[model samples]
Target: MSKLTGTTLAALAVTVLSALPAAAAPEHHGDDGLNWSACQGQVDPRQQCASVTVPLDYNDPDGQQITLAISRIPAAESGLRHGVLLTVPGGPGGSGLNLPSSAAKRLPPSVRDRFDLVGFDPRGAGRSTPVSCGLDHADLAMVNLRPWPAADGSIDGNIATERRIAETCARNGGPVLRSISSANEARDIDRIRQALGERRLSAWATSYGTYPGAVYATMFPRHTDRIVLDSNDDPDPSRVGRGWLAAFDQGAEDRFPDFAKWASAPDNPDRVADTPEQVRPLFLDLAARLDHSPLPWPGANPAELNGNVLRETMLESLYADARFPDLARLMLAGLGRRPLPAPVLPPEQALQNTTAVSVATLCNDVSWPSDPTGYAEDVAADRAAHPLTAGLPVNVMPCAFWPFKPAEPPVRVTDRGPANVLLAQNLRDPATPYRGALKLRAAFGDRARMVTFDSGGHDAYLANGNACGDAAVTDFLVTGRRPAEDVFCPAD
Candidate 1:
């Protein structure tokens, strides 16, 4: 059950407003307490912006406040409008401020016509009163951001990095940083719903967003109208982020073959091998070669092309099939067959904020074992079982040294919620694997039904262009209907 407090209610009531231009505030809408304004930058003209203030600490609601930036596109047909359909973004740090515009372009007209698409940058992200741990440039690299063990499988270096990161976050992240958690984010969502005067909210939540969406459903079942959890996460309250991280092992194993098939196609320009069977060994050999003889790559973080760098690139490329060529090209470069691509580094502040929010949420959401020995044992076992990920998934993260214990236990997603959720998943999602999606399905039990696509990739909505999965989800959102049981969408 949700552990709401009197202070939480007070925090929801505090109105710390956004500082948008005076010309942009919503005019002539007396019903909306929000002063909607034209969003800045090259955003869709239809997207209007606003902000809400929620307590920095729900337990001490009146003590401090933070703003949550929001955006929306009103229903095209107001006469037939049902209610607000919120879009919950992934990353735990990803901004949802532009979700309305994107969803407007993708969702079927029937669904779009019936509701206002709502989106928000969760507390401590994007324009929502952001926070940062102030990480150094060296630690901002993708290879370093993810905990990759040393070449010899010794976690000594990883331990030092985690400890340093944890110390940095503790020293720099203020109250809002410590307050970043799924539970608090859900509360912030509820505050948004209340501010909109909507009795209930329908949501299309993807990736890491699925966790808080499930938590919201569990916490306030009646407040949820309809929910679509896409690219689902395991709702295991016991392990939380640890389990999500560890799933990367199986996730990589599950998705690599798809990339291999694409890379090894006979006519493919980026072919790394003549046969799919040879692609795996070729990759392993290339990574091993890089590990032994690292190359000095200018402009790349750590300024080197090493085994972990290739592995990190591979992990990132597996997110979408369109990115397969990038990984294949990198493999060719590692084999002295091509040149290295230019790196794209995010601004220092953005990277810092993203890292802080992601790490803070993970560490604050649940407790991870502090002992390095346990992690070492798990890493060794995972490396043996799933060599593709090299036990990186089971490795220790900054969470191991996080200063604060969870404010409360991670919310247990139970079968207690209303039967309003429909989950859409890709069978071979590299980040949230099919098995993890099943676990989420099992946790929701009769409260939810799932549509699994026999496809490989991270996202499974309009992204994959799979008609079956998209149609099922659209039908559910357009009409309050779902398949009575779990269904499979065959590969197209």
Candidate 2:
């Protein structure tokens, strides 16, 4: 997701149905200064909230401190508690303080009984000491966040926009902003671990969260108990966040067919075409028409639905099958078959915070090419190669003009850790495609095992109803039992 995952990050998880008995779990263990109190918002009653203080800059451990908002639901049967099961939400921006309640609902009660479900607002995110770039409201648009190239594939606009955004962030974002990075997030996870009084912690991380999850596993090998990375990202230390953005090209190609198949079903009220083969060309034609003549869409951020907006919608819709109808509705409205759906927008404050962290993480993770000419060429090439994404995946981002360099090199995930990692991946994920997961798998080498699912969308284990994938990951988390070899889970 580059945490480009919009506001739907929380919905990116599958259900669990593990047949393993609770006997394989570990003994109960936990303690901390964390005081149990009901969360203030709409979270479940079982969830208790607390705060953990850590140095804003790890290098200066005793310097200035910041508070991280954390939450958790105790194991249903504390007698069976195995340890903490930390939930790492996607987005450098997504808030996880409220996620424990929701995640507990998705996890099998047997697993829940053996582990305390924990979540946190990563530094510079929600309820933690937050950071904002004071960006203009218009900058919060999905098309801008995704860095879609112009219809002609010119990146002049992208370069200028990125420069402006970078300048704005540097002007208002302070030292705390500079402290946010994947390495530091890994360090912060360790802090969370110590605060929980757990010698080892299991983790379930998806989308952008998988990067930090892997980093934590690599950096704190002895402290990690079990890790389940769903919808993974490329562990390419060289390109870093830039590689994640570029992945959308292949990701869309991998995922669009599922949407096509769904949209072309004869019984579908939102059928866009009679055959899957026709769906792609029809979509391309519709997007091309919109590129020239955008339809007025009242109340949307830009106040109009243009080709790029539709394309952004397509990328989001492909993250899950449930979102397929959103793209279908937009396509139908673009063709004048129906009125446009009401505009959906994240709350303004949340958008501002998320956009800031996303930009900071991507820019702070690595350096990006500053030359517009190079980006333009790349965009044009990508557009020709992957028409569905229209070169947006390779377009320049705010990182191109960021003022600061990475504080530390991106963490290289090595194959030196314990064999406690289980990866669940959908072959056709649009955000973190299966190809990227393959890279992560290679990086972990003998330290990990993978369960591939013949499914589409971002989340796999619980999302596609793939019982095989779900059981594999669940068994690992619950029983610490993984397949002796890499496994394949056919779609249900």
Candidate 3:
């Protein structure tokens, strides 16, 4: 399917229905009570945290168990409370522990009043007894973390790195790491619902969270209430993460114009070019020059302005409009127009855990073909077609060298689920582009309605998305209202 759609790149990468079907409802985990208490740190007065134990492998329900860290802020109006609205974070590895507090602030009063905002650090993340592959510091660098072939497109180094990382993960990432996957996440969510004693759950899922959310809806259709899948991702079960990595090629093309326009705007103090048209060429030329003659960047982690670092910066900066200046400043530094800013990196342990969980999820959720020659061919073709990404999108990741086959085939999303899902996506999301979101929308069929915003960036909800898109989602969550058909929110 990916080969045909030309969107598969490699492993680098809900509705209320109480009435419809009881058998499809979330599995009944016996009444295990949640003992919510004040969360650690300077949390909002209302924020509370609790932990739930779930099987390390659902297949062996009576086997070893792992704990999930959960947080919540009770609904503003208890009398009007509908149920739990889980805030599913991005990064198959992101911690959702703080999401409820932040999300509660963005949600409209009506929505906030009716739902207990909930968040959780998915198993193996954050406060949930984290696991790590204990990767080397150099290996943790962004350029190395994301597969970028040699300037000439030789993937020998990337292939080697993939093997080493995969082996390291297998050696160090215990059963907890092996347990991290989309299927398990959905199961964990069901456990959360059962613990919460809510037969149906409403969710606001973002980025990669959209995948598990969709999977949960597919696997347990009647278990969901009002579902809002934000910053949607492609739900193609076969390729899974591989297709997401491939979408980066088109995603970069779609999003770069926004950065270019911002960089060259007349009023912009850090203008990279006089006009938007010049910005693209200027960036390409700069990247090429750096590829050959790199610049010294002392404060930066790798301490150099190489082509891959610049490309990584571009990818990171495209996540939000406010981040455009970060890319511009880096570009300026590379051009010798300014000094490089100090790069702020997460703690080493944090990076290791995140990388481990992320790679594990992508690789474990589905299998990536282990053929290096096939990747070589794909990389060459992708390079010719989308030089901005320089074949990085289609390049191999640790998944290629993954030691284990998928425990189960990826979940195939279909229209058999409840028709309560509302998808809101940015037309030009760099991480998850419109084309991929369209695939997810199509998979949902009449079961879902997509509200696309004529915007550029990764997330499309309250952040990055305009008022139109925000209103559409807010309406769905607060009032169970969706447009008669899919709607497009014009750029603001």
lDDT of 2 by residue, 1-492 (tens): 344631101011122222233233433344587787888988889999999999998779999999899999988996787888999988868888987888877888878988989999998999999999998878888887778888777777777777888899988889888777777787889999888888778899988889889888878777778789988888888887778888889999999999999999999999999999999999889888898999998899889989998898998898888889999999999999989999988899888887788777888877788887888888888889999999988888888788898876666777775778889899998888888899999998877899999999887767788888888888888888778999998867
Candidate 1 local lDDT, residue 119: 97
| Candidate 2 ranges beyond 4 A from true positions | 5-30
TM-score of each: 0.93, 0.95, 0.94
Distance from true position, residue 52, model 1, in Å? Answer: 0.5
lDDT of 3 by residue, 371-431 (tens): 9999999999998998888889888888888887777777777777667889989988888
- For candidate 3, what is the TM-score? 0.94
* Top candidate by lDDT: 2
Which ranges in model 1 have alpha carbons more than 4 Å from their true place?
1-30
lDDT of each: 0.82, 0.83, 0.82
What would you estimate as the lDDT of candidate 2?
Answer: 0.83
At residue 51, give the lDDT of candidate 2. 93
